[model samples]
Target: MTIDTTKKIESLIITDQEICTLAMDVIESIRQDFNNVYYKFLGGELKVLWSNQNKFNAKASSSGDLKSPPDHSVTLYYATAIRIYRDGEDLYDFVSSRLNKYSDLFEKLNLGEPSCLFKDLEKEHFVKNFFFSGLTYLFGHEIGHLVQEHSYIRRFFCDSDRNLNASGEASEIEEIEEIEASASSKQLTRRQSLIWHVTELAADHEAITWCLFELVRQAQEEESIKFSQDDWHRLKENTLIFSCAASCVHFRFNGVKAVYPDEFPIGTHPHPMLRIEKNVFQIISGLEFFSTALGINSSKAEISKYINKGVISANIFWIEKYFDKNDLDSGLLMLGGVINNENTKKYMGLIVNEWEIIRECVESIKRYKPFNAGNQDLGLMFFDENFKKEFTK
Candidate 1:
């Protein structure tokens, strides 16, 4: 597969440069601790692209005396970065507004000043960091796919033709799935779908791990004032919650929910709400474990209540936006109807039950034990040099 890298479309945006810089900073931060990886910023409308000669090929059966350049590269498009930022801004506005209605409840939790935090969210630096951290998770997710060797494992067990397109968009695969009815005939299709969903979940796990690590590191580096261990932990947990909320809104705004089984089956990208719920569960569970390990008798339910407020706000925003309604009451009814559906409930339960395994997988990845060692030879590509200069000007 050949791509025309020279098809210059438009110039890069400043936000794009900042997002790329954040991603690079993350890669650099983890470079020494883990195997090296490469990144490039492509100038195109497409959001992101990961290129590798064997991206769609099965792993080699045996080691060979082969010396070649790194086979994988992660590419971020300037236009997509802009889209994410804009969508993030919209989501922040929506979620923050909704949260304000329940400001009293959040304030009672001693979780700090809700009004002040919302004010800070409007600041230029905070807004940038918000988008930056969220994009970092997304970029980390792509890197997860690479390091986890998802493509290799997938191609090894399934036919390459069953793979989704490079863009990772919904395609004719659903149509193909519909044509096959026999249980034996559908086995491969089901396997292919399951792998895709599992890989996506694996990537989400990686994103959450990296996001939490980055947030905690940022909190530790604060020098303006000293934070008690408990305070720091609270701050870290809240920041993670906020970032996860932002991510939920970000993906929800950009993605369409699968209203029909054929359009979105068990194997495609899980519903944005399910993903959000899973992240919330995992983060809260991890916090519970961490607090216990530290001998802190923190109220897990209290912390979760605060976080769930935000999650519920974001979910309501999503529901209102997607559901046609004249008022809040009608929207709530529609949301209830959707949530009560047998299919939605089944998938939600399945995802909820998988939280323990997902948490375990994330913990393992955080230890830098990805299935593949990742490619070290790729190094950092200078694809964004000109964009950086242009943006700085």
Candidate 2:
């Protein structure tokens, strides 16, 4: 099979006139949100190209149609987004009508009232949340990939035979143990285990952070006034979205519970819930500490007087109780390293250097149009080298 190596990859954004403006607004919002947090713990550059009213009438695959998925981009076509799978220069394939499937599932979940006016748009919010979660999951998965590069135990798991050898019936445990003696040694350290756990937690955090931003954007938009109890009910009904979204909500709720366990019952994904509780609480609590570290005090409102900037004042106290300066510094170092890594660009499949791409995107945003029925652009803020220091300092 001959591959069209000469074919140029293009960015496409698809949407009908009704939703196109809103979708574009979302695209821009997503871009700004991602860019703003580019140096944070869960931040990574995602080159999701926005294509509207895409003309490509691609067929849906049963389960595994795409041979090789592309590393860099996503295609959002008129509510139906398809991720492109690239197999070298030989093949490129995509999914068709993603919104249709999500919408169908949304209906299946019976998430809203029949009288819902922005019913279709509500589904978009849910779908957007899914994307946010997926992106976070991908980052964690990518961290897994990176860890496997140097992980001795992970290398064993990477081999199917090793996995089979590790798992056996209790009756066969003795035999497996005997066989294990003969097997090459590959042990896991506590640190390694913690690293793996943190990786997953980081991914979850990333997804939650993205979702929070999305929800905030919606809340700020007048068009999203249509979002109602029915919409919340609908969101809670979808299995996939509900699971991911619930996990985050559960996490926060758990925080409140931890402070007052007599109030709420336990739930699923408790580890994630606790972690979220800790992370969020800690970050908020530690804000004062961080502010102290940077030698900035807003208590007198002096900082605000100089320049009214968004100072995350709510969660500082919680983070301070659980976090040390070392922990903050370590996380910041890891985040900064990843943000500055030249290899991330390779993983993203960028042609013109990432720095250049970012430069261009920043320039383009000057004229960015808001996605429909909203003025989300009001929140758009650009950051460069100076702003990159926000989290680090």
TM-score for each candidate, following the candidate numbering: 0.58, 0.25
Query: Over 4 Å off in model 2, which ranges?
Result: 1-33, 36-187, 222-393
Tens digits of per-residue lDDT for model 1 on 18-57? Answer: 6545544543444323333232221111123422331111
Misplaced by over 4 Å in model 1 are 1-70, 95-122, 159-188, 221-227, 230-234, 237-242, 249-267, 294-297, 322-341, 348-393
Worst 10 residues of 1 by lDDT: 56-65
lDDT of model 1 at residue 279?
Answer: 64
Alpha carbon lDDT of each predicted model: 0.44, 0.28
The deviation in Å at residue 42 for candidate 1 is 26
lDDT accuracy of residue 308 in candidate 2: 11
Q: Which prediction has the highest lDDT against the true structure? A: 1
